[model samples]
Target: MKVAIVGAGLTGSLLACFLARRGLTVTLYERRPDPRVAQVERGRSINLAISERGLNALRKIGLVDEVMADALPMKGRMIHPVTGALDFQAYSASGDRAINSISRGALNNALLTAAVAADGVSVEFEHRLVELDSAVGRMVFATPAGKVSVEADVVLGADGAGSAVREQLLAEGIVAENVDFLDYGYKELSIPAVDGEFALDPGALHIWPRGTSMMIALPNPDKSFTCTLFWPAGSFDALTSASGIEDHFRINYPDLLPLAPNLVDDYLNNPVGVLGTVHTLPWQAHGRTALLGDAAHAIVPFYGQGANCAFEDVVELDRCLDDTGGSWARALPLFEARRRENTEAIAEMALANFVEMRDKVASPVFRLQKQIEHTLERLLPGTYVSRYELVSFSTTPYAEVQHRVHRQHQLLGAAAVAAAGVLFAVTRSRARR
Candidate 1:
């Protein structure tokens, strides 16, 4: 079958490689110029923290080692409070598992390279998808040359958020798309290396938690850190004047003020990215055209799972095809039905994580509670596991992870109540004496 895949980002390029490996002719259409040659898109976050879910997909094509070569291993979250010592929350008790911080552009370029190296995959750059005919499995693109229509037996929309294929599908009455935008938005900031050395610990994800806003930094290969600042939409406008801008950071993220030398320029120049959850019904359009990755679901990046989950989609769809004999008619619908619940659960959890990350992390009581939870996980072995571990480590579906976390919490509550009763009895005996 001839397949057309849109958006040569991570998911699109990876999916093209998988399909091409299966002996299908694949044409990848990307709207942007070839990313390797063109200057990197300014204001976008450069790196991503990839874990097991995303690594598994890269491993399929034997590109895991190649991809991990430049990765910076972050063993845990390093919280940078406005004042005081940094608190390190260990991700693994044994320090074995780690989320690799790698450049997003590098990963995409690697995948694009892998796809182009494959036998049957071809990429068409500077081609913007304008429309699609799902019934006939044809995609129309407005190229630099002219308008061109490419016919295929199958077309996969691996496009990113704001997908043209998803829009076309909605226009054709094949799917319904709804977006739930968060009130909070994010902007990019940077911390260049101090004297050619990383200013903070390079082995952890750095976070500066403010009650209403937060600043996070992930390490890059260049010994610098990319800091992302989150705030309410239009809140930054309050900091328009030079003094206001400096005062805002001083009050909320005092430590960052000294570390970021180019803070003012970055604040004035950087773009603020909107966060949203996308809901779509029936990702498949009559079995001829189907949506994958962000085209089907665009989620917020709180849990750092947006890119990871998208890569996992390519893996799942490939599995579904394997089980269904490569018949997209059966595979597409089944993939949608099976993956929808999982994605929805993760979407809710990711939002909840944002609250914990920004506000709760700064609370002392909340830190003690986490210590208690960590102790239980260490003692109970198989009986206890953290919500983060289940979501990031185990191959269990996202829906199942939520279920397991609730059950584990219930057990922990029961144990706590019994211990409280014992303490009360002992206290009464001591009082009688």
Candidate 2:
């Protein structure tokens, strides 16, 4: 079968590797020049937290060791409060499990290299998808040389949140696309290594949660930290000058001012990226072309599962193909059916996590609740699992995990009410006696 994958991104390149390994002829069409030859883009997150879900996918293709060799393990969130107090929250009750922090460019390069080395895989850079006819499995690409048309047995749109293939599908009335943009945006900044050593703890994801806005820093292999500032839409515009930028940080993030020397420059130069969720219905068109990853469902970065989720899509698609005996017609629909519910669950969780990361994590009550949850997890073993644990440490289906967490919360609430009633009755009896 001839497979055409649009985007040549992390998901697309990885999908190409999977298909090629199955003896299918795969060609990856990328709008951008090959990352192998071009400069890396600046706007996207420099580092991503890869959990067990993403690791399992890489393991399937035997690339886990290579990709994770240089990744930094983040065991938990290191909350840095404004009052000069630091609090640590372990992700797992056992305290040993961790998520890996890896460079986005490096990981994409690894997958691209793996796909290219496969027996039947090729990549065509500068071939941007302009049109697609899923009914005929035909595609048109706008290339640097000229417009090119091709026929395929299967076409996968791994393009991204702003996918051209998806646009074509919407134009054909095969699916519906809905994008919800957040009033908040994000900008990337750097905390370079100070004198050949990390400026902060390398084993934790550092967070500065300031109620309405937040800043997070993940360690890089080079010993520096990639800090992302999530702020209100007009917040960046308010900091117009170098003095204004300095004053803003000094007031809101006093400690970060000295740590990030280039903060002012980054604030002045870097673009503020929009945050949002993308929802699409009927991800497959005519059971021959389909969307995956961010193209199908793009959520905010609060949960750090965007890339992980995308990688899982590739793995699930491969499984569906195996189940259908390599028939694209059966596999595409199966892939969409099995994936939509899970993607929706993750999207909701990701949006909820933004609030937790930005405000709740710094609250005393929330911290105490986390401690209790950790204690329960340790005491009950398999019976109690935190939402973070289920999302990051296990390969449990996302929708199942969300449901389980909701049920757990309800059970805990009922138990608390029962305990309160018992205490009240005992107090009344003691007073009467």
After superposition, candidate 1 runs with Cα above 4 Å error: 425-433
Across 1-433, the per-residue lDDT of candidate 2 in tens digits comes to 8889999988999999899889989999999998987897775688999999999999999999999899999999999998867888989888989999999999999999999999999999999999899898899999989999999988999999999989999999998988999999999999999999999999999999999999999999999999999999987898898998999898889989999999988888888998899999989987889999999999999999998999999999999999999888899899989998999999999999999999999998998999999999988899989999999999899999999999999999999999999999999999999
Compute the lDDT for candidate 2: 0.93
Q: What is the TM-score of each predicted model, taking all chains together?
A: 0.96, 0.98
242-356 per-residue lDDT for model 1 (tens digits): 7788888888778888888989999988888888999899899888789888888989888888888888888888888999999989888888888999899889999999998
Q: Give the TM-score of candidate 2.
A: 0.98
The number of the candidate with the highest lDDT is 2
* C-alpha RMSD in Å of predicted model 2 compared with the true structure: 1.0
